[model samples]
Target: MNKDQVKGVGEQIKGKVNETVGKATNNPGKELKGDLQQAAGKVQKAYGDAKEAAKDNAKHKAP
Candidate 1:
């Protein structure tokens, strides 16, 4: 996993916590921020996955 992947996962976990807290406190701002962070994390994870796949393909193609 790249730095983005690690950071993404961390962000996602943080977001989940924030979301739960926001729900408990009835804070829409926190909830929305959490949702955004989760989405960003997903995107970063996807990007890292794609990059890894491409790297693997390149390695296999190299004689």
Candidate 2:
């Protein structure tokens, strides 16, 4: 996958770890941060997906 996709997945994994740790430790702040990180990662991954789709579409349309 592209850099964005890789980084996004990485961020999502980290967010999950943080969220789990937050719950285990009873830290609302950490939990919220983790939630935000997951959201950001989702957006980044979506963007990367769109980029890849565009590239594929372009290649298909090219002579």
Best by TM-score: 2
Q: Model 1 Cα displacement at 16 (Å)? A: 0.7
- What residue runs in model 1 are displaced by over 4 Å at the alpha carbon? none
Q: lDDT tens digits, residues 1-63, model 1?
A: 788788888888988988888899999999988888888888888888888889899999999
lDDT by residue (4-63, candidate 2, tens digit) is: 998898899989888989999999999988998898999999999999999999999999
Off by over 4 Å in 2: none
Residue 21 displacement (Å), model 1:
0.8
Report how far residue 13 has shifted in candidate 1, in Å.
0.8
